[model samples]
Target chain A: MKKGIFSGLIAVTAIMLIGVIMLTSSANIKNSGSENIAQGIWEIKKEWNNARYLLDKATTDALADSANTGPCTFALDAAKVQHYYMDTIAHIPGCTQAFTVAATAQAGNYQATGTITCSKKISNDFSIKKFEKPAVFTKTVSVQKDMPAAGDCTVIITDAQSGLVEISRVV
Target chain B: MYGENKTGKGFVFSTDAALGIIVVLIAAASMTMLYAPDSSWQKIFQSTSRSMADSAVVGFYMNKVPADMGLETEIPAAVKQGYCGRIYDYNADNGAPGIQSAPMDRNYCGGI
Candidate 1:
């Protein structure tokens, strides 16, 4: 009689121990999963920063090209800058990027600006629950601002997304 | 004698208690064996992350030179110790590489 009761007690105790062990392990698994998500976010941040740097470098390089940039009246070459930007982006991953370059002449001074954006969705099972969301970035470069030598040859631009940047702009 | 009487009526509770402890220990040991290799991989991944981050900072430094000088390198000791990689400097024209060399410890005050 007593043997049956003691055996039942032992079984119950063993089962309880197993329950505690499984619970602890599952909790650990979830914690490590969250850690992985954190690392993924870091990788994305690094990639975006890299994208911004390359875009800026590409703009500077194109502006240095003497073939297209000239005096206040003469327009700067937006096409060359776009080419450099696209070429620079190919080196980095996860940043399918975009850019805009515009040159304007006014008051006997020329100013030009180019903007590049690198963005990505940073989501996990938590945080960003939406199926589709946008992570955005935008940067601008001005030919005259960085190159003081472009004085009379200067072109200035701001968020010039719709201006002289578009290839379809009429002369 | 005292333990020999436990769970009292006719059965000795000591045997049952021992059996329960054995079950618990077996489960615990087996679980640890399953997780040991996983923890080692996690360490490798963590070190790789740190190394990549260090490399990125070095690249950032290479670009941030004084306007007058073509390049400036003044890596902090903390970052220097973690880095032992070569740097390659290229012309924007994307021509043949002009300078490619590993940083010497002597250049940064020598300890590392």
Candidate 2:
């Protein structure tokens, strides 16, 4: 009888240990997914910021030389914008694994808008999960200048789902 | 005397085993309840989304110089021929629903 009791206790303890391991594993998996998504989004944001800085520099150069010419407008070629998009993706850490980035630009009277979209596939390593869908991050920026000369620029950035993220008129 | 106490010993052992099982089950239940998946995911999603949104805003603004400068022209051109693909079409009336109208107001710098 004593032997039987010891055996049962051992079995129960082993089972409990397995339960704890499984619980911890599930938590780790979920946490990993969350961290990856967050990290990807952050990398995209950083790359986008870098591209914007480059665009600003290019625009400043163009504006500085604008005084020589009579009312003339210049825009980056679509291919050039595409090039920047590709370069940004290559440079951003872990972006390629997480999502693909696409950018579109639109020019208006005194303002221009740049839109960036990052998309990814949702999947699990072990099992086939249901309700799996692609996750996307679509961001847009509208930049406007009051005067012709180089100075402060008004910028507004927004996400399709989220209304507005940043709004400032600084150089 | 020994045989008489054997039965009582068996009873005590059985009771101990039952209590041990219950304790294990309670521990398991508590562990499961402590880490709710919904709350964990919710916290992560909110934080990540907010960060992404903030980054988009700042990125757009930083790149605006070139975009605005690229749009600058001495001579006005047709909207169709304008530079960059125009996302928002601003008019005298209600200037672009979501965004703050051009010539930002006093409260423009309030919330991120």
Candidate 3:
């Protein structure tokens, strides 16, 4: 009787060991496959966020450049905005916080590569190599409001008896 | 006779204990296999993937990604890397995706 009981116990232990091994191996395989799919999903999500971020950054940068650095006075500089927006998005060289957009279809071709430290700086290179700081894109500089060089008209009159004076100035 | 009966009874109890232990182990293994990603779990994963694709389509819209570029350049480029799907212009009949009528800056993420 003692011998029979001992053998039965050994059989039960073996069965348990086999079950444990099978369960562990199955779980490992299942987890690895799930991990791969999860990684892929995460990558796609990241790319979408990056694309959106690039677009938003361009818009904000363009607005800041247009409002702060103007090719016009009391008006948003459309030309500057357009130039800044295009150059920022297209990754034109010589722009602060900018990187190159590779023409090839390789991965991460348009990845941003530098720390952006521009505080209160709203101007971009605008890809205008012929003229740096051209008049139309000069930061914090206004077109001369008092430039009356094109034409000027002035009239002055004084009445002799009443000593009344009248003046008209238009430029 | 009584001594033989006692030994037999002892042997039967030991065998019963062994069988009970085996049953317990098998039950535990079956429970684990049950939790593995079944049909419903797969559906969940597919739904999540589709949602991510939808977000990418939204990025194409807003004209930031350039809808024309998405259809012309990106979809093909993405497809090369295990990506599947087509970019359909929003509510178009003639399917000119020919300078896109009225600049429909709309996109869908997944094919189905």
* lDDT preference between candidates 1 and 2, better one: 1
Task: Assess every candidate by TM-score.
Answer: 0.54, 0.33, 0.34
Writing each residue's lDDT as its tens digit, candidate 3 over B49-95 gives 45645555555545444343333333333331223332223221122
Off by over 4 Å in 1: A1-6, A66-74, A104-171, B1-10, B14-17, B35-37, B40-55, B58-112
Each model's fraction of native contacts: 0.13, 0.00, 0.00
lDDT of 2 by residue, A9-117 (tens): 6566759785776778688668867765655444444444443433322222222222212223333233443343344334333333223334444332112234433
The DockQ-based CAPRI class assigned to model 2 is incorrect
Judge candidate 3 at residue B102 and give its lDDT. Answer: 23
Candidate 3 chain A: worst-modelled 10 consecutive residues by lDDT: A130-139
TM-score of model 2's chain A: 0.41
Candidate 1 vs candidate 3: the TM-score winner is 1
- Expressed as tens digits, the lDDT of each residue in A80-162 for candidate 3 is 44453354433322223332221124321112222221212112212222211101111121223233554322222222223
Q: How would the candidate models be sorted by lDDT, starting from the highest?
A: 1, 2, 3
1 against 2, candidate with superior TM-score: 1
Ranking by DockQ: 1, 2, 3
lDDT of 2 at B110: 14
Among the numbered candidates, top TM-score falls to 1
Residue A39 lDDT, candidate 2, scale 0-100 = 50
Chain B structural similarity (TM-score) per candidate: 0.39, 0.33, 0.38
lDDT per residue for candidate 2 within B5-96, as digits (tens), equals 65565433455566666777786677666654546555555464454444434434554522233332121344322212111111111223
Interface RMSD for each of the candidates: 9.1, 11.4, 15.2
| Local distance difference test values of all predictions, in order | 0.45, 0.39, 0.37
